[model samples]
Target chain A: MENIHLENIDFEYAPGRRIFSGAAVDINQGELVLLCGKTGSGKSTLLRLIQKELDTKAGFVMQNPDNQIVCDRVYSELEFGATNATQGNERHRLELIRQRVAETAGYFGISRQINRDTHTLSGGEKQILNIASAMAANPKVLLMDEPTSMLDPIMADRVIDLVKNINRELGITVIIAEHRSDRIFAYADKILLIEDETVVCKDKRSMAEYMSRSQELRGFLPEIARSVEMSPPPLSLAEAVFGKAHAVYVGKEAPLSSHPVLRLKNVSFAYDRSKGALIDNLNLSVDGGSITALLGENGCGKSTLALLSAGALKPYSGSVKINGRKIKKAGENSAMLFQDVTLHFTGDTVDGKYNGMHPYDLSGGERQLAALDIILSKNPSLLILDEPTKGLDYNEKEKLGKRLEKLRDEGKAILLITHDVEFAAMFSDRMLLMFGGKIVCDRPAREFCESNIFYTTAGARLSKMNSD
Target chain B: MRRFENFNPATLLIYYMTVIIPIMVFMNPFIILTALAAGLVRAGIYERKIPVKRILFSAVLTAVMALVNGLLSHQGDTELFFINDRAVTLEAIRYGAVNGLMLAAAIVWFSAFSRTLTGEKIMALLWHLPKLALLISMIMRLIPRYLERYNKTGLAARINEERGQVPEKKHIMQITSAVFTWALENSMDTADSMIMRGYTSGGKRISGIQFRPGDAAVLALTAALQTMYFLPETWHGILMAVLCFLPEIYRIKENVKWKIYTLKI
Candidate 1:
């Protein structure tokens, strides 16, 4: 049965700025659907329209998890929806709401944190709590807008797995709009591609075939499908055809100068004196004209090391040298771009057409580029970026990768602290893994990805499987 | 686990009212002293340690108030000394000290009350006024988030100022404006989330607290002891002591029972 049906619906922010005109789509019950598009391409508008149509029967989860939360306590947030839906303060009705909240909390494996304050939860935990609260309403349809765009890979995987379980076990329909489709492509039953004020819905194989033919939308294809040249492209690593597990060259290694641009010797740092050091006696150096990537799990001190290198944070017992001279303050000889690029703008406007508009009004990718432009104007020898690709689409990531490459050609040393393994493998010359305040693995990007099973890309995994 | 925190919000409210009302009504020295002692003990039990800071603050405030009152009011028979030709008497000092003690007892009781009645419990008590309760809850949740964002924006402003992109004098104003804009923008999403969840103004709120038999027993015991306030002064003082330390006595009993059961095992 068709769970959601939108026929000839038109939506627009203003009179002339039409978002979707005569957009029609049908979603079947119990099917997992993936929505793909560029930022500001009406993916969220479509979800909101469907929600407007479905009214109280549909649950909507937005990108920013912090904004969706309405209650201070976790248990109160869990029952917020049911309480709103219930009419009178009858004993039986409130009891049913409590029971539903308890059951939903158990299903989401969030019972341990049921009584916690909402603000104290981690980003991933907050998103999970949002989903659980949405489910507590027992809606027939769920509409999620880029739910994992702000999460790390591990947390994103957990959320995706939970969504799959919800679709299979309880038979609730899910339509999720996302930027990164590599992890969820295998599980999506149908693919809905929104472009040019129109919506096209296709099955997995047909969507892959169609996306492979289009140049602009081709980046949205899964890595396994994009890498192998075959008819009716595969949706997963298991079904992909691989010839050999050859180590493909990621990029030309930049010639190392005699003196590295940034160096950290025996650096140790801790935000608090009572807790142990977050970065303990770590040593690292990045030469000029090289793009280095630092990869780690959430809260593994990757960002602290980045700050230490950028001279934003001082180590207690070690020296941070830029161009063989110890630096004393932040932005002395290096520039750093924070993960939330919107924070970089303190003015009402940015350069060019973004003038007269607030920085928060721009899209994610545009805001990032504007921040990078400001950082580059300082002419620093070393550049440090923390999670530059967060909340950016595939096209924007490609643009950023090309921009970083251009900077590397100009003899600028770039250090990226990120959770994007695929982008790291595709762009960086060297990949380093940080664990427990130490560099556990450091190698060329190709070798680093090929040797590790869990940290490798979908294409590398497919090739490895074929070789095995 | 906090044992007192598990009681129903209504029971906790009544417990605090019965304990505090008598302290405000009666000016008897015996009643005030017992209430102070019981308030200190109860606050200690809730905090798991002596609230030395609160006690010290109260002591200093009480001493200063007593001194001021004793010197200003010259209505006593037994004059101890003359301060600037104004007599300071023993009876006046005693009266001032009793008033200070009464204020100190009230302070200690209120502190203990605040520690027990957390935001959630207060919301539970205000469930009948759903709109006010939700507004308070959202404010409590969003203020910390806003403060965090403000700090982040300040750090970003500092970074920009270091790069010479932002002027030093204008940065704070810029950050304040930026955060204000960000809050206004994000509030739209918050509103959408509320609408998506089918929220209405007059909807019923569920506090998720169950009124168990233990809650009823505590309420009944508090009501029985509250009647002693109308009795003789001595009886009222003793009963008030018991009333104020009821939660501490319950906590001790539970701890002893668990210790004995574990030993038997």
Candidate 2:
């Protein structure tokens, strides 16, 4: 029997403001299921409900991971969950527990030889340790909510692969709710579409279904999904262009450049000299109306560049100008979609009319939409979005793309810093790929994705040549 | 909320002030109960900002924490009852209960008032104050929102770290840096947004918020509650409870209308 079931369930944050209504799904024992939805659609809340952690359940990774780890060192944190698991029975096999712990550590890339001191590890490493600790107890049902939204592509894949392995090996019933469908679709056996706080669609759908559908039958479509949905439902760019397709650039005077809206000249930034520069002498110029995507490997200087552009962090050297005015007030011009949607708000009130403060409190796609609201209010000449789609689902990415496109068309230059190559490739007019803190390459995002810098499940197959 | 045409903010200030400072400096339950009853009645009549779930949660949690602490910690002479060899002293336990209820009441009242004090209202009232102060106030006002977003990102980063997505090579250093950089950037973005909204243009500041007679009445009542502390302990307790309990009742009551705070958008 399933532990949780949603039978024609309808839930909304407010009455008549339906988030997910008519949501019906069943979670059988030991079943790995994926719940996908737009940011405001309530996938996370659903996971919480299923885990019976509505207030304290599934979604939260304990907001204060820094202080949450009470244990001093790394090994203790790793085995903390296992120790909790074996709280009483002295007879239960110590050897088996050790073996399990070691195996789990190996899977998560924890070294037995490493010191247990948590203070020694990096924040990402600490987070990895924290997550592994949670899995220590081996909760029969695991709810990973947008689990990899913050990771670089390679790291996200590693996590996805680990999750897939867990489902395959341990038979741990997994409920993974993620906004980005790039890594999740390949492993998901079933897709639960949550719309307006309701599960509207459930299917044993293939990535192909998502790949081929248009206008998002369930919710918002990823650009890959949208590009595929065009007549005959072309699956990739080549198909959209060459497979019964005419040049989209047909009958258009290619966009003319206005005055460079944001100019960065030989800008380089380094946290510490020994560590080297995150952005090394990067020169960039943006036309007044354009969608610019700054992409890089995880830990690369993409976000650093966003901070640089927004003037959040002073560059080690070089100059950044906004609208030909030297960048000032870093926090204002960069209405960044922080990888975590929760960090944007500055108040205690969860929901209200929120006044002008609402955008600052938005999460993921909602935050992106809120940024738009603030931008409209402020009439900013340039908008810098950092990791805009970090935790957004299929639909959210689509809405953001369309909105950013609209903003771009309206003459507001927008820079998107992201690790999701497909999002960069699909929505951006131009994409700049960063490697080891420098702009390794810059081209039209689609053209860039056509090269080796891209390789996600969607990226690999959703290319123009593949569709053709 | 939108349908209520005339909302009162003065009562909110008084209520918040009263919640923070006890209605009376005296220790008496009867007076507190009376004050609570009065607040309920007043709320029933005026129909101010509807108390939301968060306010209720804070009140309940405060009440529980207080009660639990009272039950566990206080050991004294007067015996009300005994549980597990420990005597529940009447005065000591009562002391805990009262403090707890006071806390709960305070949260409810303050939350209701807090909800009423919107950015628009503050801007309208303090527009004559230094423009920078008003702007600082707005930025400061968004502190809670930003804190929540920041915590959320940190936690999400935590989860990602566990999943093997956060690079194994760099550890948590980048996440912290990312979080810090992002927070700093958001403030700048908000500032930019404010500037973009023509905040720097020095346009004649226009405020849509207006005060009403009802608002004045709320203020008077709040001021009276605050003044009750000058009276005997009994009066203070009653006044405090009355002021504090209204928001709790408002939160529970549905489909009721009080003049909602309105601004011409």
**TM, chain A, every candidate:** 0.94, 0.75
What's the lDDT for residue A214 in model 2?
A: 36
lDDT by residue for model 2 (A323-413), tens: 6778655544334455545443322333433454534445666665754453344466767776777656666777888988888888888
- What's the TM-score, to 2 decimals, of chain B in model 1? 0.88
DockQ of each: 0.65, 0.01
lDDT of 1 by residue, A1-468 (tens): 337776777777989888767656778899999999888889988888888878878889999999999988898898887776655548878888978888988899999998898999988999999899888887899899999888887888888888888888989999999877887777899999888888888888888899988878877887766666766677766566443333333323433443489999999999988989889889999878988999988888998898788776889888999999998777778888998887787667887657767677788888888889877777889999999998888899988999999999899999999988888888888889999989999888877877888887776776677667
Q: How accurate is candidate 1 locally (lDDT)?
A: 0.83
Q: What's each prediction's TM-score? A: 0.93, 0.53
> Could you tell me how far off, in angstroms, the CA of residue B85 lies in candidate 2 after the best superposition?
69
Q: Indicate the worst ten consecutive residues by lDDT in candidate 1 chain A.
A: A243-252
Off by over 4 Å in 2: A1-30, A40-42, A53-72, A87-100, A112-127, A195-203, A206-214, A218-226, A229-255, A323-344, A347-363, A371-380, A451-468, B1-265
User: Candidate 2, A62: how far from true, in Å?
Assistant: 8.3
Model 2, B200-246: lDDT tens digits are: 34422222345677567556766665677578766655566656554
Candidate 1 residue pairs that clash: none
